[model samples]
Target: MARSLTAAIFATALGFSACLLNAAPAQAATGTITGLAGKCLDVAGANSADGTAVQLYDCNGTAAQQWSVGSDGSIRALGKCLDVTDNSTGDGAKAQLWSCTGGPNQKWSVSAAHDIVNPQANKCLDVTGNNSANTTRIQIWSCSGGANQKWNAPAGGDDGTPSGFVVTEAQFNQMFPNRNSFYSYSGLTSALSAYPGFAQTGSDTVRKQEAAAFLANVSHETGGLVYVVEQNTANYPNYCDWSQPYGCPAGQAAYYGRGPIQLSWNFNYKAAGDALGVDLLNNPWLVQNDSAIAWKTGLWYWNTQSGPGTMTPHNAMVNQAGFGQTIRSINGSLECDGRNPAQVQSRVDAYQRFTQILGVSAGGNLYC
Candidate 1:
């Protein structure tokens, strides 16, 4: 009797296991994605271009608006992957329609709160500027759990100008309204394009932080991007870096601090010019004369040089090493360790303001 009872119990357990194994998997969802003020995710003008903008528009139940969320971790519309531009994980990076290649940037996950997040950047798909108007571009930003970052995906297909920089022309003007004539926004934009990854090295938050850090340094270096060249004539001839074989072909005094970051020294000019495909070594004057070249030199320094710090300023920001490290990276020997507290405070003040303007937290470690 005992053996028979045990046998029956074993049979029942086996049947339950079989039932569990036979259960069907959940189906992938398809629907319209609605967000902020009832705007829908839209393909711009229903165009099929690879880089076509994914924007916010009025919900009209068009084929262009249809989207499906796949179990493969992709949100698809019009048979193309909703992709981050250049597979970039940086904040303010644009999102567009692209051929599905199974890239990480193409992967997205809908959260319990209905935020469509890019796992690669660990950020949310956001409507730029939170504007509900038609044709507002979509972008990736730090997941703030804000209404703009929330989305209703799998029930819909959803979705700027300012080609290079994320900040608008108006904002740029506000930042440097009375700046020097040599600081051209168009020129800076054009130059930044040459290095597609400049100031966009990591997640969206990091990108914005790095931009603020760089600009803050620039503000300190050039007095609000006003001076094209260093004002102290005494230091002009000291930047020759005589160890270089090519020497200061543009004359010893020509290598003074110039441009947004105030690039200095003969070797720096050569390195910046070579990297940008310009002849800055022989024509160091171009650093001050041409707006684009000037900006490029500044970016070259920001992206490449470590100065006194162990890592480049770009790396410092991207690695979450704090703004103080960036100051050290740029001029640690002179400014760090309470050596120049006022100068350090100035950069930190600019960073604070810029972060507020950027709609992100300033993060920790403000000083070296």
Candidate 2:
């Protein structure tokens, strides 16, 4: 919608991101810093030279990949430190295996956000061009929260995220860097039980496309997952319909947007609750308070409902109906067919970017 960013949103952005690197400093940390495509940070050729390029390689449990994080913020491997080449603070500065002298350039902070930041440069450890191919040299680039910048270093997603999911925790973090922790990867995976075939019904490419489509639409609705409730107070009391037989039992204002897909209206709560075997009509607050329930509501909408379009988003992608059909299913009435090109473009852009992150083609029919 190209909605205005609230003063409250701007004011809290800084403070909210202040904790990205606030994890207790790695104390003799004993793991590899995993990055793009699940590769590990490796020293080229296992060399101990002062300027050997630090690169991404397939994790082989090798000594070159094994790193011990220092209390003083040095990442050491092969008896050398992960140093920014020549103490450079510039973007594209190559990280190298250099003799540790505790230079500010050698200092690093492993963040909970899955970033290994060189505090001196204020940049994130990045794979040069979002490539995950082995031996791709590593460098420092401005923090973008892209998959190339995520690392499962000390206290990162590897510690808390579940394994075997199509979307790795690092990738999820990359997708919604500013998201509330309440929209957790664990919570999301837990809710997947409700729709067993979602993201699992097709070929690998189709699966990733479905996942990207769903999340792209979700990102639009929730503002990259940063917003939990609808920001417009004026619409709060208007979602209720007195004409329904249930008659907005939760209260007039209670049916306003909430959760990832912003499930609203009295009848919607009743229907979602009935399908999910919960009492959302009478206990709508659960959608806002319970992370699992919140994720489930979003999933329910994606799987079962075809609000203003001809097909469910799930069937659109899995049946090779193309990404545009998914958009039609989600918001065709207001945003499709040129009614709101900007909003439609926003969704398409997100879908393309997310499919790229998942290493899949976004496919055609990207607009309705």
Candidate 3:
């Protein structure tokens, strides 16, 4: 919940992370990568020969499909690495078996959205032409966040609600029964692609706690999600800071609070928009008008900004530093340290209720 103080300033623009994966554990896991049409990613004909094609096949209990996602970012099987043929980064560059060379071409990242990406190519491991045949080849293609690009790789957290989101639509409605139609479940889930690590790190309890903490703050900020834009119009004109090189381009009063986090300030609009490729500085009203964009702004702040605290809110919950740290990160200057105990309690109560809904303990350090 970005408040009016300079403390509310959300910082930096992350266009796309170098790797969308959470940091791999000391020993990355070895398993079969299930892909399109429920097939296993396989080495063609179970052959170990160099340059053998990597394709999709029925899930047989065979060593040909057995593979490992290494901590160093290599996918290995059949004593060879999954390689982009000839080290090409171009789209449609086919994947094949090659001896492990520790080259950039073989580097890949599996993200929270179930997409396996080749970072060097900035592309997803795609089924050629979206085919479901047994021998359909694998290739690198521009990431579209499509099902064709998704993979059920090792190391996924089972934190999602029944709808494959951290929070179910039913739970969301229960949390914000009076929430405006502007905040849609689909919109929020769609925005998760921008920051793959949110609610995806650490143990299952930690994941649920992180989700609860973020939404608790959002629930308080929006008054149980009833407000789409800031209710206090008096602060509309006050949010525009004149010192930035790109002065308030959306007019002085346009940068007021909006979205789940009620993101405000000219610099914050620029930062969130730039990070999301949305041009929010000029079209600041989009946060209130577009549900997905509105949700994206909130995620952008949660995942990237430290605000008045030492770490981002995402880090606070994942590191098990308690929900109090999230409150400090968001509005400590005005609300924490007994300056405004009532407001902090409002946030904590929501955290407790939300965690109960999630079937998890609220954990320690309930207040700042």
Candidate 4:
């Protein structure tokens, strides 16, 4: 009898360990990206072909402007990223998106030089004579190797590269504000208080690891610093309506999927609310400010309760490993397909960039 009881206890412990291991990895809280905001972009079109209008929007979970920062330090978006626009060496030439031909234009080298010059264009991504002011639009100009052309990615800014780009803190904040903190979702305390599960994770190595994983996942989902100023209602109808008590109204059933994880659909909102103890039907902004709750909403689909054996956050990532696709599903995307090799590789590269910072290696494979 004693031996049988001991075996049962060991089996229960093993089951508990397995359950904990299956939980999503928490992401670290990355600080604001210092000076590479303008370099990032969104797809903003149905077909991600050549000449798609790659616009500069704040990364707020939209599929249009999501990007991948390559280890070689190239910025990729919309299948293709910002290249030197055919490697021109003339002034007034507009920077356009092109196929990842791996030419000199696409092959950017972020060196101790800090000069992001395109030999194809003979121009550098300059800062208007190096003036770090508000709303300072970056321009491509002659590559004289001046300080203005020289960029530095600061020690904290994890752009994968060791050196490149620098901007004022205020300007950087404008480019990348704390998502939930910026929208003001009745203070961080409310969101934290609403979800005790996250708090129970504890503030040790486990919590930090989880935070890093969560932040990295969401940042990838929301397009990093590029999505700092997106319209909350752009994806969902009642997404921004605070006046609604138990959802938008009789006719407004489409107002779901908001915040970093794009918490959408009434079913999803109520489900997340049930888990986090917040009325997500009424307060959708909780997905941003409250890190714990935000993660809860993002992870709600992971459990079998929502939809068993179907495409969910955990299963999709474990299999597909594309951040863009995960967000596209939650927000109802028409153009952004995360299953593409280019898209998946781009995000995988970004994940590698962060892991490099954290000093971990998947041994060439991102999926560990």
Candidate 5:
């Protein structure tokens, strides 16, 4: 049995309207939709064509199974809504893809029992005949509060984080095959998990570019993740700017270039620490000691700092500002304006390689 009518009424009142006919709107609830026997709701053969059948398949982290549950009540995948066949309300009516029309047949709400119910039909989305086999058809059926109708929908839209992480572990290994003494693949993975939103500030393509841009810069800075701290010990002491109010809590000579992007300066450590909820201002060595922390600091710089550039590296990549802008953002004063073409070229080369690996175009403006 489905939940009581009062519960259904409350869900309807919560605005489970069908999606409008535009590009699939940004979703509030998005993730893999898992159903009977742990199978996922998959678009057949990763196809996005209208009328494609949505079936149950093995859980593979592909775009076909990536669903965005919109606030307007449409469950969408590959930019189309999960719609009923000909707006049929009868039990066993097969579900199919259609351009979203905000129709009653497309408006679905999850009941207290966790059934995905189309209110107009007052029936739950069920695996056809309660089958759990791969390629099992999905249809509307009388609510039985069965496990086949139950699903798990995590919160937040797919902004290309883990679900859309374009780089593979093998690719990462190819980029940093030897691995730094202090940096591990696990560390990078942890950082990626901790800041899943990193480089996801824009569309899927932008996200890939941002990730590539950031890795390219870090590769140039660390000699392919080979070094944990800056090699020039003399410059370490120079990074301790005495003008700030904090006055280098880690000591006069503590602030130095360390971590993936070689985070430097007392103020920078303070800022990265504050953003990551670590006491980096007081324990500057933590950046070098903790691999995950080190990567986080690098990502912190990528996502938040504009440095000598007008925008953050993340913003630069996402806004199609060109890779040269990222160079300006990182070290424009010294590298831009023909100051250090060789160094700039090295970063660009790495970026190009990464983009090639990611199968994305490097866009334009390779130099600052």
Candidate 6:
């Protein structure tokens, strides 16, 4: 009811995206479409092709299940529209849309030549598209610039930026810098250029403090993004049980790591996925690969979690140490101790590099 209208509104808004596409168009259309050769669900099951109503299905890898993305931000399989299932455009529908008229929900972006960004949600569209033969589906996700979202377009997608290309690393660095709290360098510049809401108000000292804290945690957790896997774990299960409260169980199975902190558990995945429009149960890697999802999770943790005093400073300061604490709280368990003494010490080296980059004293107190 309300959800359907929301999707309609989203679709209508997309009709006007072309107007806003001027600021950063090339970044929006950088990917290519691989036919939906391996995009179908085998468990619940649905097969969508041109002109046919696309339906939901478990990963089965059938001939009728192939899908392809287009340079124009359109999704087509068997020559049909990859639409929202039931034509319902609710805020939290699983990635189970069917073939229908090319609406905004069906429109997507290939901003990175490897990633497909969905402008409507300001995130990337993923294959849920694991390399597996079955259990693959397409869904909108945050932009991680991971391979899943990236597509190698032969003719390339749109290039709407005033510069005739998407944002460059220099431009991105200028706009986001090491201090910008939330800025991704994709074609999102157009959408974000006017988002005065993204302005930072902290003093130079506070900015340094915040950036140092953010960098420390980011360095410790991701080894500065080096520890990240080449491909995002897109096919992991959502792991929800109907009887369980909020569909997340209360045990080890429920709490597996995800994203930088690798916030685990079916509950967290469900919550995050619901907000982001992907079915967490169907595709769990949204935590890692989706840039927007990762950012959302990071922000959620920084603002809402508390943890042990030893691993991170989640409870110490709301600014930076607290953010670090959220990481430790989420990923610093003995069970998931992938970081060794040497690796831990490496964070210090990384923090030094961070300070040099930002020209600030990265408080050595939390350094590995």
lDDT of each: 0.72, 0.75, 0.78, 0.40, 0.74, 0.40
Which ranges of candidate 1 are over 4 A from the true structure? 1-161
Clashes of 6: 44
Would you give me the overall lDDT of model 5? 0.74
Specify the poorest-scoring 10-residue window by lDDT in model 3. 9-18
lDDT of 5 by residue, 17-58 (tens): 335575666555778989988889999998888899989999
Compose the digit string of candidate 4's lDDT tens values, residues 3-107. 100000011101001112112212211221234443323344434677554333344455444444443334455456556555665663445566655444553
TM-score of each: 0.60, 0.57, 0.68, 0.35, 0.60, 0.37
Candidate 1 per-residue C-alpha lDDT over 193-274 given as tens digits, one digit per residue, 9 for 90 to 100: 4444444444346666877888788777777777777777776777787788998888978877778777777777777788
Candidate 4 ranges beyond 4 A from true positions: 1-212, 225-235, 238-256, 285-296, 299-338, 363-368
Worst 10 residues of 5 by lDDT: 1-10
| lDDT accuracy of residue 198 in candidate 4 | 26
- Among all candidates shown, the one with the greatest lDDT: 3
Model 6 alpha-carbon miss at residue 165, Å: 22
Candidate 4 TM-score, true structure as reference: 0.35
Better-scoring candidate (TM-score), 3 or 6? 3
In model 6, what is the error at residue 147, expressed in angstroms? 36
Worst lDDT window (10 residues) for model 6? 1-10
Clashing pairs in 2: none
